[model samples]
Target chain A: MTAKPKLAVWKFSSCDGCQLSLLDCEDELLAVAGAVEIAYFLEASRAVTSGPYDLSLVEGSITTPHDAERIRKVRRQSRTLITIGACATAGGIQALKNFANVQSFIRSVYPHPEFIDTLATSTAIKDHVPVDFELRGCPISKHQLLELVSAVLNLRKPVIPTASQCLECKRAGTVCVMVASGTPCLGPVTQAGCGNLCPAHDRGCYGCFGPAEAPNTASLAQHLAVLGQSRRDIELAFRSFNANAEAFRREGNAHERE
Target chain B: MASKTPAPADRAGVIARAALDELVALLAGRGYRVIGPQLRDGAIVYDDLARADQLPAGWIDQQEGGSYRLVRGPDAALFGHVVGPHSWKRFLYPPAQKLWQAERSAGGFTVTTAAEPEPPLAFLGVRACELHAIAIQDRVFGVESGDFTDSGYAARRQAALLVAVNCGRAAGTCFCVSMQTGPKVTEDLAYDLVLTELLDDRRHDFLVTAGTARGAELLAGLPQRPASAADLVEAEAASARAAVQSRAMVPGVADLLRQNLEHRHWDAVAERCLGCANCTMVCPTCFCSTVEDVTDLSGDHAERWRKWDSCYTLEFSYIHGGGVRRETAARYRQWITHKLSSWHDQFGSSGCTGCGRCITWCPVGIDITAEARAIRDAEGS
Candidate 1:
């Protein structure tokens, strides 16, 4: 008898969109279930299978001390751990906490700051544990999720693209919005996987797939300035979903002085 | 199973009317919904077409960086344009698709999950570049991610027939040749049937080639002439001219970009980039999206929906109360790095397809290809 590949889905400080991406595979959900043993998925059911699981999918960022410790346990229990979504891979949106005082944010959001138990900074899963693969996106793409799971199960490398959204736009036969419409877009710098939604709907890219293989963001920024975008606007664009990402972080810092 | 097997080097043109009429009948006969470009509200849109009359006949478009204008061609021939604003995407990953619907019943709660429906289709006047776009997206949706699975996307992709039209004229912004994806449908493997339009003194000739059993089956029902060598030569020459005319500015930007990550040039562009996601919406392959679950009037029922999201929005990066990318500079950096660099680490292909939509749609008209060149030039300087 062959052993079914064990699958586990974990969460942290995130919008749960990436984890939900797994569930969003409605058509393939049943097929996926048939392919693997559902060891643990708290969002789906109360039936939690005990670990030392085959594959563990961790979502969200490390925000609390307990969460930091818990991830270590997860790391020890799982043979292979893959972080999904922007939060888990690059401290997510919560990595914004890395810039500001967490206490102040807690005080502003919650009436009693003392009631909250959190670390000063929200960090990525990679900061604390070794990750086999890091899937990038504010909310990870469902198709990418399926591929990631399949690749891990097969012990093969996932075939995700490493090009910019601009390449995708070109392939789609779309007239250059920046050239044809003079619309400010991040397609040149953004990673692919979102299926070029914004451009199809008559909008520019917002860098949801994170940065591309070799992003010339500064050149894009300068071009945007020539087109009339203010420094503030350029600065804001750099501080998005994968803000803590080193390249993006450095670019944002340069704008602060300006 | 196919009647006429053209060699891999086959090239030809068919009569326009015969091709359209045959496609319409074949689609209707096969339980497929026919959709093609139609003149609607002053722009060419993908809509349901009942007959050949429904297509944009004798209409050509003049497209430049930041502008689009429909022009009358020399002849009243339909399918004269290279591409319209709409692609095959509207039918696949629909703008608004219901992810899951939840309704409360007596016992506890009844949730209804709808699967992606496969709607067979017959798409007419699909250009070579457009085919390349669909093929690239095939990797993203069909192979790379495989999430948001639409039996509809797969069905339409497989079951639906493509009547690829070779571009005889190149728009100023058209760079399919530079990207090496088009002008001529070199890789005929992608399409079931390929068409090249040849213009003579009186009318046009469409050289048709069938690559798959399905295409041959469909072609058998149509009135197609055996393509003569002259017909094939004329068609090939027309497409070649367009390919040569449409050259991308930076041919090796992808590799050059990979070499200069921290060249201190991004700061120059960040000054003016608004970080608004306008370029992404018009792009065909920017597939980054976010999902949201909401409750109706009563909190008892909840529904989940996926909406197109941008990395430019602050809320997109919201963690706890603040955004991770608090500054636009970092956000910009992250976007370019992932597209050209890290994407290689994830998917074996480049994330971009070299579409210049970002340049045209940018309100300030920032050219991405130009930026890559500038950065490269700066490195050399």
Candidate 2:
């Protein structure tokens, strides 16, 4: 038998929910453990293993100067680097800081502002280093995370859906919250996954999975305005978990000025 | 089967609206899994029903482009509302289904084909336009077509029973009148039974007509009253009033779309189009699907599954190096052209049933009818 692939899980800055998703794959986690050598995953193990890792599952954004530099070294050492979840792929909720003054925020939130070292903007892994693939969500889904791992190990393209969330909602038989009861939903612009949860519960999607393939955020913003959403409401909606994603950032910026 | 001259026009009778429960019981007893419309997730959606009371009895939907609202209806009419987003196609060709499962067996592998068997279905409250959509799908999925057919779809569609409900009032988005498909379930369409709900201050009843011999047999077993000439007149008036369609499809759309293949209006539509697959997912007639093959982590088991796919997605058109239609403009053009123009070349009939679902369910409220007209008007200009 060939050598088991070396897998590494890296974190820069995040709540670590995305890393938890891999651990959440209870049955699949055991199988994954047997299939590959988990060289590094501080979330599950602390015994440090040095890279070059065969596959690096990166979580979180480049929030600090150190992290921006650290990602470059990680990328150089790994054969295939996949950024998982919105934080690593689209800058996560921490990227809300991208819009405002980071120094002022530090002064307000911390007692010793000088000790808090951070960058002016919370940015994605791709902003610093080239990403081979991005598996998106606020905290990435367990199934998608597994598919990404399996596909990467086997040298195949992951079967992750890049279509808008509306496809899954319709397939799950959830009525359109936007059309059905005039709810302002981001499902039209958001990527599929997250189990199509929001609309199933009668609430609008908060766009945790970020922009889907060829998302026309401008068109959706206009539709949201027609649905009676305020420009600020529209801005905030797009500036959620996946705020710093390219398509969503541009849309939120478009609304913010107005 | 369509050649068996149209159904008897005047062969109808009246049954109290509450008698639908008895009919449900009868169908359920006959090993058919009965399904009907119910108020679910703020809209009327097709779901499993054991009793007719599960129907959206006193609710009506006010639907328009990108909007739908379920309001308390004026009266106690079961089939008061027109078709909602959920259509009969979901049951016939489900969104996702396992095609085959393979398991490791002694040095080789053994494969089990087809998903688990489902009982025959009985769909209640099927609108006339919906019936037309089903007939269109039959040509694509059933043995009725001379060429390729899905064996599973053919089997499920053949065994399913349709109990259609004629429209008494049209929704603002309805254009079935222009499509020449609805306001009434005309003969030549396959349905076990057809009903036109009649509501008044004095009584609430349905004028039921049997389209097939099975429908006649079921009607014979049910409690019903021979229709009075007045009842017949009222039923005719009800369907006639439903012909008041607020939207209409332009005639010769197949030719017009073909002529305007490079029309600039498509660019205007792409500007508003989200490229979301909502319209195709809601459309009863859109039948494109893609397959996926997966293996367990142990590599002991593998399976193939088919899921509904739409042309709006770049992946749907992707081949080899990259996606064929890279721009949103091209994808939108491809969808409309296939649905309107090339569909005729393929299917010998229009693919659209004028259900107006695509219009109402679009995120940006892009009207297909209005788009077609814009292109048609641009021709003269």
Candidate 3:
């Protein structure tokens, strides 16, 4: 019998919600355990037997000097590294510091500002190390994570779609929040995932899944203005969870307080 | 079972407001899954109807570019709302369908085509524009028009009944008057049954017309009175009122767009176009699709499925090297031009029915009629 492939789950500066998505697999987690050896998942197993993992599921952004250094070692140890969630893929909400003064933020929020140790800007894993694949969403969707794991095990390209959220909304029969209600929605510029939760519930998308494939953010920003959103409001919307994602960051900067 | 005395084509009659329920029961009893519009989550959406009461009898939809709202009508009139985001194509062509399923056997893989007959569908309250949209799809999918027929689409489409309604009211986005597609169901359009709701202070009834033999067969079973001269006049007036709606397309947009291929107006439109695929997804006649092949974890079972694809996406134009229409400008140009111009050369008719779904459902409210006019009235191309 062939040896089970080694799988490792790693975290750098994330909320660990993405790792929980893997555990949230439940029955699928059992199937995954049977397929691969859980080599060094600190969240699930204490037993660490790992030199080179066949696959690595990474969560969180590189928010510290240590994270930047540590990610390279992870990339070296892993055959294929898949970054999960918005933080690992887009720098998450913490990347909001990229636009403003991080030092001033530290001084205001922390009493001992000198003791704080963090990078000036929280950056995605791809910024430091090459990523084989990326799973989008604030906390990665469980079904997509399973598809990624299955695709990796089967030696095929993952079937995660890069289509805009508008496609998903249309497929799900959810009315377009922006079109039907004149509410400013990011579905047109955002990637499809999260299962149409916001739009189906009559709320506009919060862009939890980051920018879509070839997103026309400039066009979307102009329409947002027409929808009665101020420049600051449009900026804040783009600057939310995916503040550092290139397409989003560029549009967000375009509408900055100036 | 009711006697099958097929009434002559275009035979008009009046069905009372209360007899609408009987019609639903009759269709249901005839083993057709009757789908009709009803208020859902503050918008009129089509769904399975157990009773005619489920129809949004007194509700009306106010639709403009980037805005839609549902409110109660001044009077109780069934089929008051215009088309919402849900097009009848969703039921006919379907968003996703399994083409084939493969199973791994000990000897070899056994494959079964996914053409299992679907339940017969009866669509109620189909707008006049929608009837035209369905006929357009008929040309796209029917064996008589296309070289290769989509068996799956053919099966569902053939085994369905289209109950259309002449528009008594039109949304601000509607331009059917210019397209010559609707506000009235013409004799050429293939609809089983068509209804014209009559709502005055004294009368609450529908002027019904059967366009097909089966429609006549179904209508003969239901309780209705012969259409009086006054009832016919009222029905004609109702449709005329809707046809006078202000939003309209230019007389020769197809030729205008062909002449102004390099017009900078496309770039202007692209500046506001989101390229989100919402317009195509909601469009009744946009029939592009992409397929996916997936297997289970065991690798024993595999299935190939097709889902609706849009020209606005980069992947839709993807080739061996890269996407041809990488810029949103190029993609938008391809979509609108092909919809209004190239489609006529390919299908002998315009792809758009001027349903105004593309306008009202656009995130930016990009009106095709206005864009066509801009291209036509350009200072210099």
Fnat of each prediction, in sequence: 0.12, 0.68, 0.55
Tens digits of lDDT, candidate 1, B1-381: 122355453433254565667678777878878888877534466778888788887887776555566779887656676565566776656644567888888888888877755557777777776776776667666642457555445655666666677778777667666666677765543667777777767666577877666776676777666777888788778887777554375755556767776667787666656565555655565666666555532335666766555675555676897888766566666666565556556655555554555554554555666667778789854
Q: Any runs in candidate 3 off by more than 4 Å, and if so which?
A: B1-10
Give model 1's clash tally: 135
Q: For residues B1-381, what per-residue lDDT tens digits would candidate 2 score against the true structure?
A: 212334565668788977888999999999999999998888899999999998988898888887888899899889888989899889999999999999999999999996677899999999999999998898877558656888888888888888999898888889999988998888778898889898999999999988887888888888898888998899889899999888999999999988888877888889999899899999999999988877766667778889999999989988999999988889888888888889889887888988899988997888889989999999845
State the lDDT of candidate 3 residue by residue for A1-258, as single tens digits: 988999999998889999999899998778888888999999998999966999999999999998999999999999999999999999999898899899899999999998999999999999999999999999889988887787788787677788899998998788777876777899999999799889999999999999998888998888888889999999999999999999999999999986
Tens-digit lDDT track of model 3 for B45-152: 778899989988788888777778888888888887888889889998889889899999998999999777567999989988898888788788873545678877
Kindly report the docking quality category of candidate 3: medium
Q: Please, what are the lDDT tens digits per residue for candidate 2 over residues A1-258? A: 988889999998899999999999998878999988999999999887788999899999999889988999999999999999899998999999999898899999999998998999989999999999999998889988887777776566678889999999998888998998889999988899889988999999999999999899999888888989999999999998988999999989998863
lDDT of 3 at B316: 85
Return the top candidate by DockQ.
2
Listed in order, each prediction's TM-score against the native is: 0.58, 0.97, 0.96
- Candidate 1, DockQ to 2 decimals? 0.06
Ranking by DockQ: 2, 3, 1
What ranking emerges by TM-score with the best candidate at the front? Answer: 2, 3, 1
lDDT of 2 at B29: 96
